[model samples]
Target: MGILEVSNVNKRFGGLQALGNVNLDVAKGTVHAIIGPNGAGKSTLLNVLVGKLVPDTGTVLFNGTSVLGLKPFEINQLGISRVFQTPEIFSDLSVFENMLIPCFAKRDGSFRMHALESIASEKDIIEKAEHMLAEVNMADKRHMTASSLSRGDKRRLEMAMCLVQEPKLLLLDEPTAGMARADTNNTIDLLNQIHDSREITMVIIEHDMHVVFSLAKRITVLAQGTPLVEDTPDNIKGHPKVKEAYLGEAAA
Candidate 1:
């Protein structure tokens, strides 16, 4: 059994079927990529996994436990973390401060609004945050305002925030979207570092074939809200159906 399993899942919206009997198994500590053309329900599937959307049928299991009805925070507590396509850091806060937020949340179980209590006083939290920043190679920019950082740095900071929680599974939605070539390569390297250092399982949704082939041990192709194919990178590249549905005939 994989660390994360989606078994016969289905979702619908009014007259449209968003996901139809989709099944996926993500092995532990492996980078699994999900790719498809637009309107393929890739984002919808991610929403379901992160607890933003409830499926109409089937179950989502993480590490052999059911995660169907759990809230987002509850799911996080179960060791599943999600990073959105856009960086969701505090623009007004420094990179260090942003990392501290997740550390605090993981420790305290929720956000504390007491402005008088110095966040610096939380020594353990500070250390954890700094360690995560170092893991993502953002330690040098820890004191910089999140808004002042470049786009790639913002994404790195967000990743640091998630990593501080020590999640078992990391869900990434178009992690390299809108990045320049250098930034995309940097993101890939960071992900590689994370995979090597942690036992975290990953499910990545990406449009770039290069990034998918480089990072993923296995790839699943979704088409019209259903799984079209799931195979190794080499098999996916040669798949005629994948070429017909996603990669153009000329490219194949």
Candidate 2:
């Protein structure tokens, strides 16, 4: 069995079926890409995995444990961390301060109502946060305000914030969305670095084929709320159905 297993999952919103019998198995320590056209339920599938939305039917198992009804924080505590399409950072806080929040939450539990407590006094937390920044190559910018960083830097900061908790599974939704070509390539390199240095499994939802092919060892193509194909990057590049359904003739 893979580290993450989704079996015959289904999700519905009112009369709309957002996902139907969607199943995926992500191996440990590999990059898995989920690609689809707009409204093909890619984001919805991510939501189901992260506990933002519960599937109407079927099961989600992480490391052989069920994770269907858990709260978002509960999911995080279970060693699953997610970075949204938009950068979710504390804009007003310094980069170091932003990192400290997740470090504190992971250690002290999710609802520590002690915002007034001085995080600096927690040497272990500070050290862990610094290590996380170093992992993302953002240690030098830790003192800068999070809002002042460039788009790529902000993405790096958010990624570091998630990594501080040492999650077993990292879910990234459109991580390189809206980035310039240079920034997109930088993000891809950062992802490669993370994959190389950690044993974490990553499931990425992206529209950019270049980004998807760069890091994904396995790619799952979704269409009309169902999985159409799952194959290696090389196989997917030449698959006839993938070309007709999603990749298009030009990409074939």
lDDT, residue 248, model 1: 67
**Per-residue lDDT of model 1, residues 1-252, tens digit only:** 999999999999999999999999999989999999998999999999989899999999998999998888888888889998998889999898898888888887855577788876889988888888887788899889999999988888888888888889999999999999999998999899889888678999999998999899999999989998999999999798898787566765
| Colliding pairs, model 2 | none
TM-score of 2: 0.93
The TM-scores of all predictions, comma-separated, are: 0.93, 0.93
State the lDDT of candidate 2 residue by residue for 11-106, as single tens digits: 999999999999999999989999988899999999999898999899999999999999989999899999989899999999999999899888
Point out where model 1 deviates above 4 Å: 111-117, 247-252
Model 1 Cα displacement at 56 (Å)? Answer: 1.1
Clashing pairs in 1: none
Q: Indicate the residue-level lDDT of 101 in model 2.
A: 88
